[model samples]
Target: MNPSAWPAPAAAVANTLLVNPTIASRASARFPLALLNLAAALDRNGASRIIDGNLDRGFIDTALDALAQTRFDALGISVMGGPQVAPAIALSRAVRERFPQLPIVWGGYFPTLYPDTALNADYVDYAIRGQGERTLPELIAALRGEGPPPAQIQGLSWKLDGAPVHNPDRDFSSDDAPPLLPYAKLGDPRRYLAPTFLGRRTAVHQAALGCRFRCTFCGVAAMFGGATALPAAQRLARELGYLKHGLGADSVQFFDHNFFDREADMIPLLEVMARLELPWWCYARADALLNLSPATWTLVRKSRLRMAYIGAESPNGAMLKEIRKGTRPDQTLEVAELCRRHGVIPELSFMVAPPHDTEAATEQTFEFIREIKRINPQSEIIVYIYTPLPEASRHRKDRGKRAAAPLLDLRGEPVVFPDTPEQWTQQRWVDYACHADAPWLSDDLRRRIRDFVTVLRCRYPTVQDLRSPRWAKRGLSAMAAWRYRLRRYDRPWELDLADRLVRLRRPQASGL
Candidate 1:
């Protein structure tokens, strides 16, 4: 239907109900920035409300109740492709059953990576790929009979005659000066803030959108297609000031895909952070931190940069290059030492157990992690199995070009990816998405990885574990020292017993 032929806004202002399906525990939950941004855009021409499942355990019922009380034009569910897929499916099914007429749209990494699969389910009506700030409002307008038909909406995938129809991908929006996120929509925003290693009452913000790097294995690359935009300095100051002075957030966590971009582009933002000095944590690339000038380093220090999560994916330079990670192993080591000198904890993550040379690669990475710890004992280590994205899951621009070598299972069978959201919710696929396990990892290798991780973490207890008593950490460190030094990472049943009693937090699973 032509937009001109549709009813006027006076007849109905499109109202949307946005939901972020449960992805984290209540204590680990941060502000739902994606939904907030979408809400801001929706409010520009219509009305929208947010439901973060992380904080609300009974979110499915709450969403239904909200829909019952209000005339919501559509329901937008934000889904990621791991454990979140299950809750998202449940919520989508519940909403579909109750509000049969209301349109249900799925967005975020899950749909962006597998739009067809997302739309395969009977519950999900439309899948919004890429940035939804623009596509969402436009989709809602079209659904409300106020705009063009579904085929004309870019970044939208919908079913036509029971078949998924994917429109041309949308260009990355210039979010240099986005509208202030409607945090007020989430009543009592203080509930979103939580204590972290950075400071008490740490709030989360995203100063940049997307990431420039196109690492073959990274979900960010598939979502953004190597596009990124940093916020304006004024916008950063305004938002940070409000987060600090207005909401009493003692610290901030910048959830930018890659926080430290080019040095020249980062100086202004760093200056604003320095002025605020609100202790911050962020995701950074090893090359970016290593290339920063001394002056820029001073600003970073003055800004109270507490921790930087660097993806040191592998110890082998060949594997790093094969994955197009952009940074090398030496750079990872250098950044560890550099972060140590700058008083920033380098939370380094390594992806071990590749499809080929699974055991040898895993052993190499363990040794490399030891070298990093020797350089800086304060360096926090995160280990994950190397699970590359399926060729079909790559962004359209990247698909079929430099495709990943075919994956093989232990029996030399081809590794097949799930073709539906329900399949993705299966334990094996969920493990693949989370980078926790893979099809090719043998039982012995998996146990070895677990044992090594247990010993390594016990030896160097992460400072991020605020719940575990310091005395327990010290005692665990003392107990694990011999195993760590001797490289005897066999099943440490005693350490396992003690760890069960202590219940140390896994920072990789629940970020600060």
Candidate 2:
């Protein structure tokens, strides 16, 4: 038979609806750009009629009623980190109950890492591992009887005869060149808020794929085949332009794990961002921030790089080494000071209650928090219990598994760390409150600490001010004054006392 006589390809048969379950945050939520990008990818490949839903926005009943009304061909739910797993499961179960005939497919890092576990669920009919930009459309086509069978679809998992089967991973490096996100499917871009920049009209985008550095606790590098690559700077620029003009977005947060794996690539991308003049923030390693040059700083200023969230993990040098964080405490300090000098707010994220934490190490972390506050009073510090990601080999111990289980939903709960006393764990939690200062605490000190805060709040009155960051600091300083006056406390001593007073109620209030 002649090739020219072959049959024409079939069009996309089923309309799709993608769901991004709530990350359990009420104050703010990010746009489901990953699912949107998947929709756009499907659209480019002749698959249209895509819609989106957030569990946080509408009742599950309403969402199901809408899906019932539309009769979508398939349901795509995105589950990235462990924190999103429980919500995704709930959404999947609800969708299955409402639309039993409709195919339910799970995607994103969680499913990618645990395909078998995802497929084993009673509600999940399929799972798309790694990247879904290509696999999803093919799966939809297959479901519609247009494309290959499930066995032939790469990067997909399905159960057969009560056993889960995973096909080969997709080579999706090219998929990093993101298509225009179908924000229209989401409706009312204004409703999507980014609170980091004071609730600006914001969207999330990715400039690079994968990370060059392989931190032992992370699985990104392994997931992407240890390849760190960048999309064309001009291409990224065009996508951002479309997001701005087409979707009314004024700010973007790069979802890249490490936006600057290569300095050369980053410089060109920063140059393009400078031309666009959109304020942005990204996650980067401490080393990357410390190495920024004067020219790069100028470009950063022009780009309005308002913040950098550095993955400092821990302030103790040994803990940093244990996690293979590839940077020292001094480098973290340097990066924090550097970002401050360049007028970019440095938000450092640390992990407490790691697998090997010692009481002494926890003490170093408490002191480290103070050093960061002193270096930049306006700096934002985020703390997490070291979560052993599902696929990582380093966190294979019994304790690691226990620690990882509770954090699967990204909720702030007390976690177990090996060889540490409960008092130390309690102390770490109190210090992580981000108050001006708190000393090491125990159960007996609770009442005294509360009384101290009550008295200080009465005198300082300004402690409740929220007009601006400066005002908050002024209020905090006034509260610190009490510790200085009565106890003859110096700066560090006053900060320690303030920390104790402000955070005393947390440990008892937030149960272990």
Candidate 3:
């Protein structure tokens, strides 16, 4: 491809359009933080616009109208692996059909995990893997015949003569003194502030990037390659102050892949939060929480931390080590008690069913969850099937190292993963991505897990469900108390029927 053959750079600054095709309901939808960050970077030298499909039911047509009206150099789509893939495909195909010449770039977790699969489609002109803050601007400039050719761009996958060509992966960026995300691009930013258990107008922010641990089953590990970076204290203070004062956000939900890092490094940020005194929720590790110094814990309490979501992936210590999840089961139990004492709810999520020892592992996890509930009745439990990423989907740095064992279905046949975006739209594949179901799960085992979950949730209706009435929750709890006490979690037909009437919200689905 010759640079000279491409169109000349426009006299005015280039404008790029970003679309977030997440298929979540409006009530559950939070801010599209990924697009906002990209838009902020693009605004430095060029302008960018955001179209959030989660809030806009007619986003496809809206995006088409925008493209037809405005002169956009490129259309960047933020996609995730599961339900978002179908909408992304629809939007990409629609834009390509309507405007035949515009460049379509796909980014976010979907492209980062499967770059070749993303580039395999005729609609996707480029797939920006890893961080797109820097890659996107460079690619946009290159498309305008003003920068290096496509082959030179790092962390990019492009088709060369109808063949996918992936360049070397780019190192993670140092998030030192990063600019504030352009929330204004989303049109009244207040609309993104949702009502969660934290507060009435809860805003989501990511003060840090990536996770240091390389948990094999985690998409974050595959996307970030075990690298993590925290924001400067001043940057966090500025952002939080703006969100509170400028935007009227009463609470915050930190979407950091891992919020709590080293104790010494976290003090300044904790101090900032303590001063703000905003009720907050964050994703934390059991080990990290247990290791926090007494002084830091004081700061955490002063900050009014309402809840901490910890991934206690499994009760089996050996399984934890196998997945490279650095935390131990003991730490999980300890954190439950610790959170109880600190007046913070410990929302612990566990991966119940594993490919190997499927039944035993799941049953053990169920027992472990019961023990946690006994230790701290306020502890919240979330269960997910243990679904490991395909070897090919892993980060290049960790792909061949400590490769996963071959996975087998219940029929003893090797489990195969989808190769293209369209295939991922299948119901089974979507369920797999969401960790709701797995290929190795038998019909009996699936029903058992569902029945157990029904009983467990009914016994202790989650505090996060603001929609469900108080009388309904208490009635469900009284009805489920006997089953939960007797451990009769099999075939919970009565609880299931009652749940349908109450329509309780699953916190796992919304991540609130």
Candidate 4:
């Protein structure tokens, strides 16, 4: 139920049950969707179908095996692209190798940005380039019983007897429809999490979709063409009623690009969520809702709004401008202060070292995280390494200019992007370093990174998890930059980084 975008497709789906790759070597897989959304989309009109299996590593092979021999009608692959491209393309290849007639479809953040490249994969029968919330069902109908053979559908690219075909973009069909999933459904907690804990139940919810802000890192704006918020009560009633009456979900996690982008609508929504009594967390830019009122906080507390992840993106002022993060360090602190005052936990989504990050900037961000971590045990420090986001940045435009794309190994490879060969080796080192679990520190500049994290944990009692910072939250570029640099040394800089990173090796702490 992305507030801004249309709900999941209205067309009776072709029995397609979208599934995340089940723990494909840990990182290859994605977490589950809000059960409500999945249930809503699991419809029967064109054909009952699911949209997420392509991303699941465990069942992908099985799904493909079924696709090859089974009499299935439609196929969809959703990948965020970049490193995910290899698996996505490989899966499509697997599908083609197994079943030649099963009309395939591709969607997700990647295809939306590079429709042509997605078409390049011979295995892809059809590439869904935009919001498939509405388009997928329609495209399935156009294909299931045979209407258009991939040539006429909008927002798609497909093959016509081995040749690529492109189509004009179409507006989302479910633009005005209700959410595909009923919020009152409350989602099956087990289905969303491997463990029934306070953390795992906190799966993502797109009460609204798209973003009003044009932060360069987010794919929502580029993929969805910017902000679109569903009416507040219209959307709130679903989850509010559910949490209060249907299921007692204490915490809610938001997947929206910016929860506060539509403050006017949010205020009323908060009122409803508060009345319902739930806890929730969502991503936000610094003070995006600067005028957030106490009622907002009370409702937030009532609705289980305990945490908010804030993105500083860069500690360096200039980089923030270059990337258009739309917020600064001062504003970021403001956000933390506001959350603290309101008794909401705050996590810093920080960039350690990215394309524009410097050792100095990294130091500052580390200190910032430590400072916040000192204040709240619930405070989590997210560290990210930058990587090319096909749709998020100018990645697609830059891809062709890059020397070459690396080949993928399906048997199994680490589930991530390695911008360079050195990166591959470095990640290996860090992986091993984590196993070593030493308290050692380096005399070099990276020593500060080690020092900062060690101190931050002590300062913040609520910071229960003592491990490597969360990766995706840190900014992918940041992770890569520091990982590449830190791992470059012949010797392990410090055992703590690896020790800290042990958490990453755990089930994806990134999302549900």
Give lDDT per model, in order. 0.90, 0.62, 0.90, 0.51
The regions of model 4 sitting more than 4 angstroms off are 1-17, 23-31, 34-44, 51-58, 64-70, 82-90, 144-149, 159-166, 172-189, 193-203, 231-234, 240-248, 367-378, 388-512
Cα lDDT, model 4, residue 27: 26
Worst 10 residues of 3 by lDDT: 1-10
lDDT of 1 by residue, 119-162 (tens): 89999999999899899999988887789988999999999998
Candidate 1 stretches with Cα past 4 Å from truth are 1-11
How many steric clashes between backbone atoms does each model show? 0, 8, 0, 69
Q: What is the lDDT of candidate 2?
A: 0.62
Estimated TM-score for each candidate = 0.97, 0.74, 0.97, 0.70
Per-residue lDDT value at 422 in model 1 = 95
TM-score preference between candidates 2 and 4, better one: 2
lDDT tens digits, residues 1-512, model 4?
A: 22112122333335553434222333222234422343354353533334344243445666655443334456666655434455555566666665565566767765665565566666666777656655666676565554564566676777777666767766533244344344333224324422222343444456666665555555665565554665557566775455435544455566766676645677777776666555566777666645666666566666666667777666667677655666777776667667777777666766554432235666666666645544543555655543324332233323233321332223333334333212323443333222211112123434554444433332232232323454432432243344333433223334335434443332113332
Residue by residue across 105-217, what tens digits does model 2's lDDT show? 88877666567667777888898877788889889888778889989998898999878887877874564344556667766665664434422576777768777665656
How many Å off is the CA of 349 in candidate 2? 1.0
